[model samples]
Target: MRDLYERAITAGGLHVTEGSKLWEAYREYEMAILTINDGNDEEKAKQVQRVRALFHRQLSVPLADIESTLAAYKSWEAEEGNTRDPDSQVDDVPPNVLSAYKKASEMYNARKQYEDELSVVAESEANKLQVFLKYIKFEKSFGDPARVQVLYERAVSELPVSSDLWMGYTSYLDRTLKVPAILKSVYHRATRNCTWVSDLWVHYLLSLERIRASEDELRHVFELAIQCSFPSMNEYLNIYLTRVDSLRRRMPTGLDFELIRQTFVDAAEFLSPQLGIEELLLLHAYWAKLECNIGKDIAAARGVWENALKKSGSVLEVWQHYISMEIERGHTHEARSLYKRCYSKKFAGSGSEAVCHAWIRFEREHGTLDDYDLAIKRSPLV
Candidate 1:
């Protein structure tokens, strides 16, 4: 009967890790026998062995969330004794306990020796950083949250000026610890130590978003990030995008259109110095689309495209977007006139093929057959 239950459990648990009925029944059966005839010492010892053997066997297999088995094992150890002696022979110990003991002893020895090994070879900055990274990774493998944090703290204490170390430390706190206060605290500490690293501030804002902070809170964070002197235009763009995305999702009432408009303007101003004319053209196009889509401000959208074309009239696609916007607003006549203006530019950068093709498509869609034919015939060769 035990053999039959074991076979079914093995099959059922092959793909299971938690909340398994087979696991519960097995543990309950062992517990029931162990509790009966409590006065018989030899029988009780044998019953205890049967339960211990069950845990050992269960531990040997790849069970997910071993917290249950590990906790049970610890309880059994409290009742019997801890089997964590390094020099003790494995032959006398149960198989599961032996495996756990060997792993624990190995980890203890490595941890005990790590400091001595580091103090000798950490002679240069590069070498010391490498050793610290190895130590941090080693602590992580133990899956002990406290030890991992201690190692991170130790690394940061010695290398607070190192942005890489600070970043790694904060990321561990954010991803592994997943404690909001701890994440926020470390990010604050990290930014103070490495204010020049813009990505840290970006990540801070994102973490706030993840916790579903208020718009006022997000605005405060964005303002704070802007106040940081080390941010580049690209970082500013990211901050703006994050804010816009969060607000877009919520679609809350009393949204501050003016603040968002100012963000777009500020982004263009800050980035104009770094971007070339062609890049600026695309940037304006993107901003125009944002105004159209997010703000539904058609006048503002038209203003952006007009400004872009006035500065970059030579580009074909910018003109296409401008005319498309007009057409989209039901101004087919205006779109046709804009197409004529585009052809008249005859700018050296103009690829006449795309212009003529677009013109033909526009006329065919919005004008009569006569208008379309006129477009194909009157358009110049590339």
Candidate 2:
């Protein structure tokens, strides 16, 4: 996970100033180990020595929480007073604990910080979220999952409509904290607050699928996701397709190909006015390929292609693919007729060159001299 984060931060063009979040987190992880207590004196002493040395090693360079960490180190030495020879090795712990040292470092400061931030949130309406964000990250840095959960809950209560905060909170629980019950409750609430966002719905459904929710629960999310408020049919179609893609890839055993086909048909029908004839035709075309590739329903695939072309016959790629399917099935007569329809359409879309080339190639390989001449003569370019 550390390697993954390093790569992500480096790839993201994070400056030293921007990377304080990660440095703070790393420092917090090491600090948590300072509190562990073992039975054997030798092993216990060895462990404390190592952790203390670690603090010193990191002190050579600056960290995001250098003052807080140094203060904690000082408090630790004061607590370990007179146990070993004073002159044996490293310097003694400093005078005051960093923010009350261990107690302050662990949880005491978090409550104080939260209260402080809440007071500010109530006062500042405009750019006030940065305060709550600071509190949440501090809670997360300390390694108490329950404390983290409470902090997130309090955060979203004040800012119900912010998608980024909700996503970050839910993601922390889902991935870092690993509390399913908390995650589910939060997702349910977040969707209610953020009804108009498509990607939020996608992420919510993806979480459901990741946890392998019941088919009924999954369907419930899917139903809600399709109704999300996108500006256009094109955007709505993209969200609808994201749900279908999850079913195809993630839940294959329960994958009902018929349900998938019906979904495409209904989506096209439901939004056809905004989609227009061209977009609707394209949906049917993709559905045909899905049938051929995944459902292995060649007969239904061919049926979709033929039906779509009859209603909307002008797209060049669709015509080309239809011709290939017919010839692949040894129906040269059918292929020849489809090619004739392509010529009849006179290359209506922007892909005339590719379609004409495909026609010429088909005729040279499968057509008579007369057929070859017909293809060249009817070319739109000519």
Which ranges in model 1 have alpha carbons more than 4 Å from their true place?
A: 1-106, 121-123, 229-232, 277-282, 324-334, 348-353
Clashing pairs in 1: none
Global lDDT of each candidate: 0.70, 0.66
Q: Model 2, residue 247: what's the lDDT? A: 66
lDDT comparing candidate 2 with the true structure: 0.66
Q: What is the clash count of model 1?
A: 0
Error of 1 at 134 (Å): 2.1
- Measured with C-alpha atoms, the lDDT of residue 191 in candidate 2 is 84
What's the TM for model 2? 0.62
Highest-TM-score candidate: 1
For each candidate, give its TM-score against the true structure: 0.64, 0.62
Estimate, for each residue in 1-382, the C-alpha lDDT of model 2 and write its tens digit.
4475445333321221223365445445544554565467886776667656545543432233545556555565666673243432334543332223344334443355556556766877444577768777876787866556655666677788988778888788778755556567888988889877666777777788777777688778889877777666776776667667776775367667777788777776676557666667667767777887888887888888877677556657667767777787677778888776666555655666777777788889988999899889987766
